[model samples]
Target: PQHAGISLLRVLLGFAVGAGAGLALGAAMGLSRRVDDHVRPLFTAIAQVPALAWIPLAMLLLGIGETLKIVVIAKAAFVPVAMNTSAGIANVPRALVEVGETFRFSPLQMLRHVVLPGAVPPIFTGLRYGLTHAWIALVSVELLASSEGLGYLLVWGRQMFWLDTVLVAMIVIGIIGFASDKLLAAVEARLQRWRTDGV
Candidate 1:
């Protein structure tokens, strides 16, 4: 339980950092064609690199420590979040934007009343994917470098030849990930109360 808690905390922190940055950048890109044109190409290239691919360089730069894990996890989370957010904002129905403009809404009011409602669903989607990516990167880093945490739990199981332990760790990881995703889905559903779904 303690190890699981530790892993969860780290994943949450890194996810928050990466997802927040991505959300901001994506919102900016969606709001402005100029910003999108300038940043999208660079982000596209950077997103091509996998989280594990960044591990060695991160280790050299930040050492095999918490910072390294957080940075790698951040990379894993950022791409999906950024991409989804940009898409969400861009896809906000033309009619809705027109409605807001018709009301002569201020920029802040426009975002609050129009943009948020349309964009929130995909933003949550990005968050969900970001979280999953963070989990993967966290475990990978832990397996390679950590003294403890859920991923190290797997390492310990492997070293001790404890198949049951390994199986349990894997199960725990799955349950946690699934539960988190479901929680996000539920929140999305709540926030979009006018929409109905089979879920």
Candidate 2:
């Protein structure tokens, strides 16, 4: 339980930073052609690299510390988020924008009434992906370099030939991942319902 808490904290902290940055970048890209042109190429290139590939470089720069783990996890969370968010916003119907303009809606009003609601579904999708990625990255980092967390428990148990402990940790990780996915799905459903119901 202590290990679970530690790992959860790491995921939450890293995810928070990643989500914030991703949303901002995605919003900018979606709203501004110039930003999209400048950033999209770099983002796509980085997204092609596997999360594990960052470990060696991150460790070199940050020395296997909590910062390294957080940075790694943030990268994992950031990509899907930024991608989905940009896609969602870019796909917002031109008809809706036209209507907003017809009504002379303020920029804030248009975003609040049209852009955000249109983007909610994909944004939630991004959240789900980002969270799963974050969890996966956290476990990987813990397994490779940490003295604690559930992933470390799995590694330690294996090293000590404690197969039962290793199995338990593996099971725990799977269960946690599944549960988080389901919870996010539920939240997405609720948000979608609210949108449909004019809430």
Question: lDDT value for candidate 1?
Answer: 0.91
Best by lDDT: 1
Question: Could you tell me which 10 consecutive residues in candidate 2 have the lowest summed lDDT?
Answer: 190-199
Q: Please list all clashing residue pairs in model 1, or write none if there are none.
A: none
Expressed as tens digits, the lDDT of each residue in 1-199 for candidate 2 is 8998899899989998888889999988987899999999999999999788999999999998899989999999999999999999989989988999999999999988889888988888898999999999999999999999999999999899999989988888888888888998998887678666865
lDDT of 1 by residue, 34-137 (tens): 99999999999999999999998988999998998888888899999999999999899999999999999999999988998889988999999999999999
Q: Per-residue error at 94 for model 1, in Å?
A: 0.4
TM-score of each candidate structure, all chains considered together: 0.95, 0.94
